[model samples]
Target: MNGTISLFSAEASGPGLADLAGVLCGPGRMAGFGRTAARLSAVVDEPWRAHALARECRRRGAEAQVSAAECGRPLVRTPFRVDLLSLERRWCRGEGKVLPEGFRLDGGMLRLWALAAGSPQGNNYLLALDPEAPETYERLIAALAQLGVPAKVQRGEEALLRVTGRRRLLRVLELIGDAPLGAEAAWPSPVPVVRAV
Candidate 1:
């Protein structure tokens, strides 16, 4: 079974996103979904991976087409180019699935995951989760805490989990390393802002 992860991008940057995409659509290969446009797609022969791909795509404001080929083969493709700029606004308000079993959120992995799905807006960084999986969100909250990054999980239509404060945001970004394309300028620096007494 050949498995691959695909990511659609206008430019070749965002290694963090690419890494997360690799894990999301991996145990296979990573390549362009098609020649129609600038799209990143993973080719996986297994049904389970395809399902995971579809779920992850939905969570990231994209669509995953399984076996969209001439002969109805098992070739998964996410055609809608993921717009990272507005991803948080889109997915936060939508429905999503739980993290697949055995998916670890260690420092490196978490960094990549954040880069792929996180949104750095205003003074905080938001990570949206599917309200369907409260348990998963709880675990995520705990894990972030373990990493010394305090986060708050707000239950609502968007079900947002925000990492506030410049210190925490900088720590999260430090873990994430380099930001994705179009995101470099937006990455919050490690400089701390002084508050008025």
Candidate 2:
């Protein structure tokens, strides 16, 4: 077998459900809600984030819908998909969603996360994280470094992983592929290099 992760593979395309990890990144969560059918949901501040997440779900063969949430935010949720029960098993540890063992980050995963949590702060691109999950943030830093992109964690109520510099920002943008429609404001911008003429 070839030594590469295929986009078609079920094991999340890179290693350990990276595609699904994208779904769980940021404020996303999976819940069984006292039943066998599991659902994934997240409250995103921007309308574009909700729409983008719904599209990502559809791309993975899951039906998702966007709805208004409290605090005037938009929420993207999947119907109680019995199919997602397996994911719930991996991510849901009793109450909170936790990263599974051997978790790795991939482009698709980064794309989904950047939709809901990425932003440019000054010269750095910041990817938000759940402050409660310190381990997850730690692992994320390691994973990005493995991909040749070093990141630093800025802890706070809403923690952030800061990716700085032109080359690193470009690398991050390359990893996430393309920005979704209406995400121009929420996504990071890599300033084009200008030769001093």
Candidate 3:
């Protein structure tokens, strides 16, 4: 399983994420996550939805920025964690199984599992693990529905990690720089194998 995490953005600079940071740390903590990137990655046919997500993040308590990408799948930056994407990747695949449909077994597009948080704006957080095979999409949807945060698997058309190694995620940020856009196009960062030793 691969690990990856994402935050919402608004105004192309991650207003949603900024808002989240403000609320969580009581001001000025937004920078803990880092600056926002210029562009970001999203499920292939859902740029607008992605935009909505960024706005939502601002509403939560953090700031976000987009990163650039040749494939068009964007990335973002934050100040709270070490290698946000890599951290997210570790969270997702660490305890989860490989999702058959939403994402590939190897690190490719991010496969997220959102849970209901009960917040007024809609409480949902991503699960660290990927989905397991034979775990029908319908079942996952039903589970999320029970939690009150309905979700669908988000996969992209582009294969960002076909032959790439997991360590490439770190290089992504280096390659892009602080343009706040595509500074790190690394999609799914390296994660410990779910069942492998």
Q: Could you say which candidate leads in TM-score? A: 2
- Candidate 1 matches the true fold with a TM-score of 0.46
Please estimate how well model 1 matches the true structure, expressed as its whole-model Cα lDDT.
0.48
Query: TM-score for each prediction?
Result: 0.46, 0.82, 0.29
Regions more than 4 Å wrong, model 2:
1-18, 33-35, 192-197
Better of 1 and 3 by TM-score: 1
lDDT: which candidate is best? 2
What C-alpha lDDT do the candidate models reach, one value each? 0.48, 0.74, 0.27
Q: Write the per-residue lDDT of candidate 3 for residues 1-197, one digit (tens) a residue.
A: 21332222122232322222111110011122233222122221234323433444444453445444456753333335443333233223333422223321110111111110101011212222222322434444443344233444444531111212334333221221222222112122344223223
**Model 2's TM-score against the true structure:** 0.82
Q: State which candidate, 2 or 3, has the greater TM-score.
A: 2
RMSD (CA, Å), candidate 1 to true, equals 14.2
Model 2, 64-150: lDDT tens digits are 899998777899998887788887888778767688887776777777778878888767888888755666877888887876679
Go through the candidates in order and give the clash count of each.
Answer: 9, 0, 50
Q: Give each prediction's root-mean-square deviation over alpha carbons.
A: 14.2, 5.6, 17.9
